[model samples]
Target: MSFRLNPFKVMRAVGIVAIVVYGVVLVTGYKKSKVTTTESVTKDMKIRNKDFYKSKDYKNNLTLPNQVVENNNEAVAKELEQTKPAETVDLQKDSDTSKQQTDSKVADKNKKKEEQVKLEMQKQAQQKLAEQKQQEKSKIAAKQAELKKQQQLEAARKEQAAAQARAEAARQQAREEENKKAREEAAKRARENAKKHQGSKKYIQVASVTTEASARGIAKKLGGNFYYKKTTVNGKTAYVVMSNMTDNPNTLKAMENQAKRAGSGYMIRSVGK
Candidate 1:
């Protein structure tokens, strides 16, 4: 496995090393400055003491040794006091400089940290926005797909309904055709039977009336294979409603029963008779 260096960790280590190096340099310079100041002060004092010892004032002071000694002691004391104050000012300035440098470094470090935090927050916000947009796009796509699916299903249903309608219409037309053909065949058979029995068969009469209109009305009410005929009844000119002509006794009997069910009375008679 390869070692992957984290940038943040590397940067933090570098800052720590820089701080340690700066601290060491500041401490070493401060110590060297303090030593140099002490040495310079001691050399100046030694030169002044040597000049005082070699001067004419020294020879005069020999006559008043005690007063001269006291004056020299006071002068030395004043020099030491003045030198101590200057050294203290230098030390205080060094300390203040060191403190300022430390404060500046701390401020820079804090500013960098804040910037990193802000950058991280901005990145997170952008990522969240992208995720939301993706979700919205997904929703829209899904909705479109669902809509398309529903439209297809609806179209299929409509097509199915249309197909059923067409099939039903075709079946209804076929039924109508069959019914028409059956009616035509029935009419043809009735015409042929009427021709075959003409002038040589008998008919069942269901109604005898004084008016042709009444006889026709009775025949219409009697429905199939019935007609009206002009005749005489009770010595008055009248009309009669009759069943279809037939000579078979069984057919005549069945027609007689049918006429009896349709009217109040019925009679069977030969066409010419």
Candidate 2:
């Protein structure tokens, strides 16, 4: 099969290659520029040294004093005297210019150093201020957290106390209701007893018989506070077995129930005290 190239893939590959080539060109150009600058500085230094060696000042220094005397001593002496002051003045001017340039450079350096020191101090002060602010923020955050925790604890305590109070109130209400019910039951019982013992005397008649001996025997068999009594029933004399009298209807009811369990008949009777 013939190889087929995708246009998009070809474009992507071309773009990548172009980028790599551009980066390489940029790096090469920077290196070349650095090398050219170094070469130019060296060439300039060589030219200056060559020119200095060729200058009149260098040639004059090389000439011997015997050669100046041989040429014309008096004329050379006069010319030297004439040029001496001018040379001295030129040297002074050069020295002063050099001093001024040095002083100017020193002042610039001092100014730059002062500016640097001021900037450093400002940076330190700003950093200290920032740190102080950060510390204060941390303290405030910690205080807020502690306050929130305390508030939550207080709320929890209050809620617990309220719950306990509610429970106690409910228990108190329950106790009050129980006491009220007990008192009402006792009053109802008292009322029933009052109704039952309306007359001067009330007794439970357990049994009636013709003879006292029979009545006494039944009272003994019945047990529990039973006695015998003589009574007229149907206009005839009869002996009756009796339970003890009580003003409490509850007690009378208990006696009746007991008698019933023993399979005996009973009647309530009022008699003279």
Cα-based TM-score, every candidate? 0.45, 0.35
Candidate 2, 1-273: lDDT as tens digits: 223345456456655655565555555555665666566555433234657878885688568587665667677566656652311124344445555655565557556655766676677777788989999999999999999999999999999999999999999999999999999999999988887767554567777899988888888777876789899988999998888877667877787677777663555454434
Error of 2 at 62 (Å): 27
After superposing candidate 1 on the true structure, give the runs of residues whose Cα lies further than 4 Å from its correct spot: 1-96, 168-201, 204-237, 247-249, 253-269
TM-score of 2: 0.35
lDDT of 1 by residue, 1-273 (tens): 223345577568757866786787578768877887888666556444657877887777787779778988899888877764434337767767876887677668757865776676677777778889989999999999999999999999999999999999999999999999999999999989877776467776676788888888888877777899898767889887888877677877786666667756455544633
Index of the highest-lDDT prediction: 1
Q: lDDT at 260 for candidate 1?
A: 66
Q: All models: lDDT?
A: 0.76, 0.71
Q: After aligning candidate 1 to the native by TM-score, how far in Å is the CA of 167 from where it should be?
A: 4.0
Number of the top-ranking candidate, with TM-score as the measure = 1
- Rate residue 40 of model 2 by lDDT: 54
